[model samples]
Target: MKVTNVHTRRIHQPKEKVSKLFKTLATTNDLIWPYENWPAIKFLEGLNVGSKGGHGSIRYTIIEFNEDDYIKFQFSRPEGFMGTHEFKIEALNENQTEIRHEINIQTTFETSLLWIFVIRWLHDALIEDAFNKVENYFTEAKKKATYNFWVKLLREIYKRKPLQTKIA
Candidate 1:
């Protein structure tokens, strides 16, 4: 199966300020990834083109890293995820920006089932949490994320597996 998935958030901050996120992505001090509660997203040799990284049980390689604008990671694990997932920033105005997280993948039969039944649920929840953090940073507003029962359940499962605590 070939799939394209995207998640986006509107941030009420200057695009210049928002763009700083790209500089520390997948690093120990990242502001976007909620690594304190979830698995770290780390680039084994720093975040640059051709670097490698992962979160939880998924692994990927950085194929593109365009400063302040976009980054793309091609999946390398949980087999059959052939394609890249990327984060893109689009300036909406002087005081607002749009952040889009997207993934395009062609999967094998077994991996398709994994995506349909498992990975999608976890992925959505994780990104929701990520966006909430970003919103908090710019708006100083408290955002609440309500997960479906399955996402909540999957979180418990994923939390059991320990990965490095590199990204914040």
Candidate 2:
């Protein structure tokens, strides 16, 4: 089964700032901790790291990575099935970046079928919600003092109205 989605937004921070955020978000340990805290995070406890970071082996697994571009990893779950998650990042502008996440499930017929059902359920109920949480984090980060210039400009743009004009 294949699941893919793309979400894009204009961030107030420069590409460097956004890149740092993406790097933090993409790291295995960083990503894992949030999951560790949430109830859903516990679902993939035993899945070894396989390969981590850029071209590094993780949990004895071989994963692919493109420096500062993307990362992909594959692992088997407790149910004896394989799955993969890929993350891609792109710079849209000096002050904006795009992040994309893709998920794939590979397994035997019986296991795949079971996972298909569960994955769909989780995608609809939990994964989507998790992505929203990530989006919120980006939004909040853009509002910080470091991003004051962009935020102030945006606020000014919002306050100006073409409809406000003097009538004779």
Candidate 3:
């Protein structure tokens, strides 16, 4: 099975301001990873091609890096996940920019089942929080992520599990 998802966020900030973020995009991008109370994404090495990193139970290696524009990571986890995911920045106008995060993967039957029943649910919530974080970056009033009932319940459940056992 092939699974592809693209999630985006448009910021009021200009591309130049957003581009400045690319340099630290893979390393300390706390703006997108829900670092305060959630699992934070981190690269074990430089945020460039060949760097290794992961968050929670996920593992990936940077495969492509285009400074100020794009970065791609090859996933190597979830038992049968095979593919790449990327983050891209596009200038929409003189004072606006957009952030796009996409995942493209080929999965085995078992993995497809996991995606349908488990991963998909968490992935959506994760991305939504990421979008909200970006919005909060520019606004004076803080923005909070609102998860659905299931998302809330599942996250609580995940929090109770052993750190080494869950992909959350």
By lDDT, who's the top model here? 1
Superposition error at 111 for model 3 (Å)? 1.3
lDDT of 1 by residue, 51-124 (tens): 87788768888898888899888888877889889999989999899999998999999999999988898888
lDDT of each model, Cα atoms only?
0.83, 0.44, 0.79
The count of backbone overlaps in candidate 2 is 4
In order of appearance, the predictions have TM-scores of 0.91, 0.50, 0.89
lDDT of 3: 0.79
Report, for all candidates in order, the number of backbone clashes: 1, 4, 0
Candidate No. with top TM-score: 1
What TM-score does prediction 2 earn?
0.50
Order of models, best lDDT first: 1, 3, 2
True-structure lDDT of candidate 2? 0.44
